[model samples]
Target: MEPARLGSHLVVHLNRLKENFEALKKRYKENNILFMVKADGYGHGIIEIVKYAFNDLGVREFGVATLGEAITLRRHLSSLPFEIYVFSDLQFFQPELSELYLEYRLIPVISHNDDLDVVLNNPKFSNLPLCLKFNTGMNRLGLSLEKSEEIIKSLKAVNRCKIFHLMSHLANASMPMSTNKRNIGQKEKFKELKEQFISAGIELERTSLANSGALEQESCKEETHIRPGLMLFGATSMAPQHVDKSWWQGKIISELKTKVLNVFDVSKGDPLGYGSTPCPQAGTVAIIALGYGDGISTRFMGATLYHKGVAGKVCARVCMDMTYVLFPKGTDIKRGENFWIWDGDSKMFMELARETKTLPYELVIQLTTRVPRIYQID
Candidate 1:
């Protein structure tokens, strides 16, 4: 059955995604790419992105935030021999989860000593590949450096959960100059912990310290694997100072387009949208079928969008399912005309993000399932 059609939709360009992956692969020639598909491929649709990456691009490893996501991917790609690493903590005590982990062959990243204990106690996880995350500086997840030796000793004693990878997250790989010291310190700390594990006679197969930002830093390239999330999807969270923008080959993979639902002429001092924010002067307002409900944030109240070749300023508060944009007087806008909110243009989205005082990740990932994803593979 056809789903209820919404005028608003996100167009994901598969070719662009492939290009971004190739660019990163070429740039980080030494490291294996663990393409991050968490957050629904950063809101690009996970299953689709994973299929393209695995079937077309030959990406053998994937990184997800949850075990559920890994299970879903495993089911979808049952025929493919790919490894999925769940970055989130695994509920090791749950027998059901242990069964699922064994049945699907999902790798869990042991973050803390408690999690390690769970894995060690469960003989079902024996001989299964595992990843150990150290909290070098992120402090979000992973074991602390102070407890690294203790954890390693415990793991060596149990001899369960084969250590496939040793990894850490960089707190500031984007701003190379500003966070240079912190980045170096975190790397050193991770290295120290990794060496400690090695010296304890625990053989670690691979190490991944570089994320998308760290992958670009010359100093942060010493790793066996790199997990690139935003950059693989044709966007970057890195600051400009750290990268030569001109040399960036990644293209925006998602294009958000909607049609003008209504066109109305307003008088001077008239108000629009939820708050009735007064229109500065008499002008034409084009109401598009897109709003906060569709992941367009309220912060985009005064954002600008282009239709045809003319630009229009978003006026007033954005409604749940509609947004009002004001254009100049006598503007020729039709109800069915395409309103380009974000059209696979990185600069435009960056400008919008700046105007809204939000990050690109927030804007993209918050796009609810209400907006259908249309793929442009060619």
Candidate 2:
């Protein structure tokens, strides 16, 4: 069946995801891969990414930022042999959440000592498998070194629920310069915990400590499992200082395209709409129906968009639902022609990030529900 048309009309390239996973798998063949699909797979559509990652890439484990996200993913995937881990540490929803976890066979990350307490006492987690998250230096979630060792001892005395993997998150993996310090520190911390797990008789069968940034860092590959999020989406913050063009070898997995709504010529003296912003030199102006509300940054007002091999500068103030661009003199532009806002062929997103002073992660998330996303197969 042909997929239904999207209301907002954005396209997600599935082939790029498959290629990225293939590349990563080739690079780290020894490690188990847990595809991180949190934040809607970093705003790339979780279900679609999951399908490609699992069906095409052979990924059997997934990571989510919240219990809600895990539940949603489970509902969409019926009986796939996948391990769904919730990265969040919240335990308040234990009752309802535990029921769902049991129902869907989801793996919950136990962060604090209180987490085990809540689970052991909760009726739903009586016999379910739980993944313990150890916080080496993040100081965010997971049990501390001292606390974790103590909990490991306590679990030996009780009906130790099934344990999936011993895991920790890397804070400095993305910054290649900090790899020595941050990676070393985390390795030492996890090493201590690994010993404790052995002493406590927990096999620590499946272990993971790497995110996207750690994939490139040799020190992070120490763990048997690697959880990658950004790299699988073909977006990387691993930009070198000199900006090597070869670094962008991976294909862009997401592209935002919009059609020109109207085109007209404006004189140099004429002030453009809103804020009475100064108009460009006498030239053709094209209005596009994509704006901040649709994820285009307001700082992109002066940013450039390429259409039919010609570049146009976004002019005037960008409204909530629309923006205007001025094409060079005599440059023919027609209505209904597609405009490339951000695509594989251009550095529009990189420019937008610089102009808005925002990270690529933020820029993508801002693309709210107003813009529809269509998943395209390779």
Please write out the lDDT profile of model 2 over residues 53-164, one tens digit for every residue: 7787888999998878888898898767788988784444546555666777778787877777777666566676667888888788778777775676667657573366
Best by lDDT: 1
RMSD of each predicted structure: 2.3, 3.0
User: Per-residue lDDT of 144-245 in model 1, one digit per residue for the tens?
Assistant: 888876777777778642468989988887767235788878888988887787778778889888776766554446778888888777666777554562
Model 1: residue 36 alpha-carbon error in angstroms: 0.7
Question: How does candidate 2 fare on TM-score?
Answer: 0.88
Per-candidate TM-score against the hidden true structure: 0.93, 0.88
lDDT (Cα atoms) of all candidates against the true structure: 0.81, 0.74
Stretches > 4 Å off in candidate 1 = 1-6, 160-162, 177-179, 240-247
